[model samples]
Target: MIINQSIITDIKNIIVQSKEKAIRAVDHQRTLMYWHIGKRIFEEEQEGKERADYGTYLIKLLSEQLQPEFGSGFSPRQLERYRQFYRVFPIASALRTQLSWTQYKLLLSVDNEEQRDFYIAETIKNNWTSRQLERQIYSNLYERLLVSNDKENVLSVAKNEKFPSDAKEIIKDPMYLEFLGLKRETSYYEKDLENAIITHLQEFLLELGNGFSFVARQKRIHIEGDEFFADLVFYNRLLQCFVIIEIKTHKLTHQDIGQLQMYVNYYDRMEKLPHETPTIGILLCADKNDAVVKFTLPENQKQIIASQYKLYLPTEQQLLEEVNKELESFEEK
Candidate 1:
């Protein structure tokens, strides 16, 4: 029997979509099953166990028996993971089946309940993969978000709900650049840094946080037929706008802000959708003066954001100092 062209096309489309749905359903079911298994194991382990010996022996015996049968996935360490998984995700209903075990494991690392919840909401909202979630957590996404936003505002953003229109509302301070793998005090051309970011684009996107999709690097823009190249260009799904980024190897300067503003304005007028939010500009600088950043633009400026990038992770003391200073400043204001 010969199928009509339209009928064949429709059949193929239906099969493709059905397979996709089936895969997602299977994954969700598997995740829920693991959760249940973990919960049962934890409950059994905790039943009238006031002693450490029973717990230790139980894991050891299970590991020995399960390892030969089930192999590496059932090691003693993995059993501990299952136990901790149940502990961390006590409420099975609250678990996001779309998120993998790796993402949930990362969430368990966050000791703060509120912060963990925020990341979880954002992860689900954005449909981030395990690697993406890990990158955001390592980059201190929650702390940076909390820098200038109040608890309510931050929570709302994390929940993919409405957020106030402010530069600080969207920008992550001291933006993590560990993906670039550049050493401190090293001199590299802007092209080199851009290439590194491109090489590890997924990690870069995670560090950049939600909504960013890379459009191009060294994107050209024209003003009065004079060409200027943007270091990077991205479109933010959340903000529904273009993001023009400029890279600066030196401390952020007034000139850098002006240049970025020009690009932002150009994008707004030339490329932005009429209903889209204003184009957002970011200056990724090696260093920044917080006071200078405050005074460089209009007090109510919402389109442009300047942030410092660190090649290596900040020391705990440095992080503490920055956090304390920001908290103090907030208190003063």
Candidate 2:
């Protein structure tokens, strides 16, 4: 009396899917409950009481009573969070079925409305996990993109309106590779950094931004009997071009720029299809002289991108504490 292997597999899949759906359903309900709680608290606070005093009083009293029946999720701090969640999102546009209670909580930690909205948009577009969303916020991803790219493109990303038509919109200056597990004190060679990137390729892709697929590493190309090895090669679907990266563990020089430019030329001339745009060359180095980079590249240079890499990343707890500090400062004011 044994079950068929395929039947067992099918049953296992059903159980797994059901569990996932049940979890999603529970999360959705919890998020809705929080939203409703927030709304009621806001309405009650607005009636005849001063916001600073009455709001705090209402949440504290509510938490004390609800804690005995419902456990610690109804703590005073949690109630205040719910109130803040409502205050930020409001009745018009707060509830998104796709986002869980935890994700919404992360969004609520964000102080700026536009930045919050942008995070929401990106989170939804990329289907980012709660952890990924947290990382993006702390990393100042929106701020970084806003630097080189235009405001409209940045704001309109969630609207699905022509995000990153060019390479510059997605590329970051001083790319953070703290996920590579490289130590700051240890001296590393270019190959070591490249190896780290290859090892943490998934996180590297996230740092690289959307629509990039790894093509090759140490791609060998021969030009008139001289052979050159491109450090890393990637294809960006958004920009429709090959992105060639050369890692330098030291300050960028004009000669390094020239070498990267040559690699770009080879890719554009030999590798890329006619329909694709010109190859984009990037030199990811530790430090660089902007004046040198400016003088080295052409005035109309859109293909060549040079970015510095940082080895440290802020922890989630640190970012959460920063948010708390900001909130405390605002309260003090």
Candidate with best TM-score: 2
CA error at residue 171 for candidate 1, angstroms: 2.0
After best superposition, candidate 1 residue 102: deviation in angstroms?
2.9
For model 2, the run of ten residues with the poorest summed lDDT: 322-331
Give stretches of model 1 more than 4 Å off: 1-30, 198-202, 215-227, 266-274, 313-321
Model 1 TM-score? Answer: 0.81
For model 1, residues 1-333, the per-residue Cα lDDT tens digits are 786899889999999999987877777776676677678778777883887687777877888998998788778887877777787778888877677766777887898888888888988887887877777776677777788888789888788678546657767887878767788778987788888888989878777776789999999877787999999999887778888889888888888898898899888888988899898999888888878877988897888888888887676578768877887888798
* Candidate 2 Cα errors over 4 Å, as ranges: 1-15, 48-52, 92-94, 314-333
Candidate 2 residue-wise lDDT, 1-333, digit = tens: 886899989999999999988998899888878878888987898884855688778888999899999999999999888888888888635577778889999988788988888888788888889988877877878767765655678867555777566677889875888889999888999999999999999889889887889999999999999999999999988789899999999999999999999999988888889899899998999999877998888896898888988898756675457445644544554
- TM for candidate 2 is 0.88
* lDDT (C-alpha, whole model) for all candidates: 0.81, 0.84
